[model samples]
Target: MKKIEVFRKDKWNMIHVEIQGKQLVVREISDQWGEDTHIFLSRPALMDWVQERFSAQRFEGSEEERLSIIEKFKEV
Candidate 1:
């Protein structure tokens, strides 16, 4: 069975998540956007989740590639 922990508390919504093994802590947020509910994940968890669920191909290369891409917009 997976363990669940509440990292944050808010009056509007209660946050909870399933965690396994030694993975980094993930945060859950609940909010309303014009009557629609929104749940957000922490940065590290968000990146891993998106890649695992939405990516069709395996990610290649290193962090340098990502840094260089971000550098292109620094002057704008």
Candidate 2:
């Protein structure tokens, strides 16, 4: 698995995004709880989530560039 990004919610909480084969994995890590929660999504599902996330937002760059970045994740 390759880590794509990590977002720190606070001092003790974090969100991790990773790619394992062709699937995407999201993990919620809590230092205080001493446990992690994970969610796995296939390529299609990942694309669906991405579409939903950007539904109301505008891309900073060309749409082709944004799509290329998404394609890079799939290559990983």
Candidate 3:
């Protein structure tokens, strides 16, 4: 797994995106504050993230969590 290249600096980490790479699995590097991390290991991994973390179930969580995931999904 190679390092992930930034497709969109602000929105890249929020959604699963792969560009300039044939491989689906990607290694990630993050900053100290955990703002720069995105490890896309495979198509399944990305899909799993979407289904679990960014799914409609988010609406069942707190208002803050629901709004946050929705806003992030809007960027992609």
Candidate 4:
């Protein structure tokens, strides 16, 4: 399982999330605010979840590529 750390929010309803040490900006479409925590997702997952909550995918990518993309976007 991948570890995800949710960061501060930004304008346009975007939330910064760190997955596997890489940061990704995802928008807050709709959510179920219940009990204690919340759940967020990107475009694809949101679509899938809307259709079926159990819908999920096994992503496949190289670590180098992921890290390279993250490094390219690093502010400093």
Candidate 5:
């Protein structure tokens, strides 16, 4: 598995984005509960999710790097 990105929602919560084989995996971790929630998506579904989630926002990276990350998701 390869970690693609991590979004820190707050001091106690985080969302981890990763790739396992051909699937995109999203893991939500909460410090308070000591539990995690995971979601898996195939390429098409992952692309749709990415589009809907990130279309109007800029990721926390350089433009070139952000585009590279998106391309990596597509390639996988």
Candidate 6:
């Protein structure tokens, strides 16, 4: 993908965002910490809460295990 040129990261790695016109695109980027990061949430607080909970799990055994965990949160 061509770089979006629509977003930026601050000195503290806090992201600042913008999009051309009204278009929105979801993106994932890797930080210096070597983990994937996500963007473009309509409900950021809820999304962050979900991330916090999911990150606590030690049950990531396989694809089925991961899917089962997600299925438990489908309504959230």
Name the top TM-score candidate.
5
* RMSD values, in order shown: 12.8, 6.7, 7.0, 12.3, 5.3, 11.6
Off by over 4 Å in 2: 47-76
Worst 10 residues of 3 by lDDT: 6-15
Better of 1 and 2 by TM-score: 2
In model 1, state the lDDT of residue 76: 16
Write out the backbone clash pairs for model 3. Answer: none
Model 6 vs truth, CA RMSD: 11.6
lDDT of 3 by residue, 1-76 (tens): 2333322235323323443354443223333344443455455565565556546655345666655654543343
lDDT of 1 by residue, 20-40 (tens): 444433334446522222233
Cα error, residue 57 of model 4, in Å, equals 10
Which residue runs does candidate 4 get wrong by more than 4 Å? 1-59
Which portions of model 6 miss their true places by more than 4 Å?
1-59
Please, what are the lDDT tens digits per residue for candidate 5 over residues 3-74? 854555576776567777766786657787765655555667767866665454645556665565466556
Regions more than 4 Å wrong, model 5: 1-23, 27-38
Better candidate number, 1 or 5, judged by lDDT: 5
Better of 1 and 5 by TM-score: 5
lDDT of 4 at 12: 31
Decoy 1 TM-score against native = 0.24
Evaluated against the true structure, the overall lDDT of model 6 is: 0.39
Model 6's number of clashes is 0
For candidate 2, the 10 contiguous residues with the lowest summed lDDT are 52-61
Considering lDDT, which of the candidate structures 3 and 5 is the better prediction for this target? 5
Model 2 residue 8 CA deviation (Å) reads: 1.3
Question: Model 4: which ten-residue window has the lowest total lDDT?
Answer: 5-14
Each candidate's clash count: 0, 0, 0, 0, 0, 0
lDDT of 2 at 32: 71
Model 4: per-residue Cα lDDT at residue 71:
40
Instruction: Tell me which of candidates 2 and 4 scores higher on lDDT.
Output: 2
Q: How many backbone clashes does candidate 1 have?
A: 0
